[model samples]
Target chain A: MKPINEMKLEFVSKSSNESFARATVSAFIAQLDPTIAELADIKTAISEAVTNCIVHAYKSSIGKIYITVQIFENGKSIIKIRDKGCGINNIKQAMEPLFTTGGDERAGLGFAVMQSFMDKVRVSSKPNKGTSITLEKNIIPRFIKNGQPS
Target chain B: MDVKIKLTGNTLTACIEGDIDHHNAKEIRECIDQKIEEESPNLLELDFSKVQFMDSSGIGLIMGRYKLMHILDGKLQVINIPENIKKLIKLAGLASLNIIKE
Candidate 1:
């Protein structure tokens, strides 16, 4: 297996810091030659994951979010978001759509949306030990009219 | 974020500006819900004309509004959805909600 190109970013769990994380991922993935829609999907997934950390994991408790991204030579990209805050007790229930632990205002579709946009999403949480989310996608190869990959 | 509210008869229009990601979605939900409850409008129009970006959080806001308006026997229409947002809305299979573009 070819070694993947990796980039790491760490930031505080601040609402305003979400953009910085998104930008960092975007910049790193831009090297992979993703399409516009693919880029949008990546950004959206990152936003959802980071937002979940800020709103749920941290829950007003100060913490840090560590994001690690790896781009494989085969155009496969993997994003790992880890948070050292309160962990989820029921990962399965939390992934259910519209099942929010929050008040009536939260739609609780964070995990669902992330699943929709990414090719693969996996979440692992240990009670009081924190949670980590891994998102992966394969960039579709562009082909020219001559039947050669672009 | 910029929020514009317009009243036409019993209908209320909310023009949202800027990004509607997780960071600001809760605030948007509260603001819109409060206005809807206060005015008790028979129709609500959400204008995404000026909205540059939105993620799943935006979808949650729209869905919540749909449920809210449904309980009141009112209607919700999304208008001027940007291309990117339109793609997302379609991806979410929410085009059936009667989102119109200008």
Candidate 2:
């Protein structure tokens, strides 16, 4: 197995940076042999993760969010998102479906969507330290009828 | 983003194209709200057939439109949701909104 190649990006926790983060992740994932549907799924998952950091992690503080993307030759992709801000107190409660922290115009579904799109998701947080989310997906290459990759 | 507003009798259709992220949500919001106000349609349909992508900002846009429709006593419907976007919408517990697929 080849070592996974990684890309890292750091940006301010502003709404405007959301698109930048999403686009960055999309371009990184596109290097892999992912289908259009898979690309869309990965992009949406990245968007949700980055948006969560901007909206909930920093809350009212001025901070930056870091995102890392890694892709393996075996078609496995991993994304790690971290924020150096007020961390979540109860990660379990936060992962519960439809349980938003309130007043952020969120549907409490960011984590849920991330989990649904990716094959694996792990979230770790410390009360006053920070929060880190890792997402992994094993991409299945799509093939054309002529025995060529699509 | 480009929003095309069409009115037929009491129904208003908004065809949305391009990406719906934080970058263009404000323009989309204004366009849709303007159409809602000017047409005063009893039914509002948001067509996403041409939309390439959407993020949480798109969810915010939908929520705002839902609230506006509630205030006007009109029905809001979303059509032609792509599979990837459908996953986000479902995960967000927005299926209760009963977005129609075509």
How well is each residue in B12-92 modelled by candidate 2, as lDDT tens digits?
999999888756778888888888888899989999988889876688778778888999999888898976687667666
Q: What fraction of the true Cα-Cα contacts (under 8 Å, chains A to B) does candidate 1 also have? A: 0.40
Report DockQ per prediction, comma-separated.
0.51, 0.48
Which regions in candidate 1 have their CA more than 4 angstroms from the true location?
A144-147, B33-39, B71-73, B86-102
Cα RMSD over interface residues, candidate 1: 1.9
Give the per-prediction TM-score of chain B: 0.93, 0.94
lDDT of each residue in A30-84, candidate 1, tens digit only:
8878887788788888988998898889997979999999998878899999998
TM for candidate 1 is: 0.86
Chain A TM-scores, candidates in order: 0.93, 0.90
Q: Against the unseen true structure, what C-alpha lDDT does each candidate score? A: 0.84, 0.81
lDDT of 1 by residue, B1-102 (tens): 778898899999999999888778778878888899899999999999999778878887888899899999999989888877766686666877665445
Stretches > 4 Å off in candidate 2 = A102-104, A141-150, B90-96
RMSD of each: 2.7, 2.9
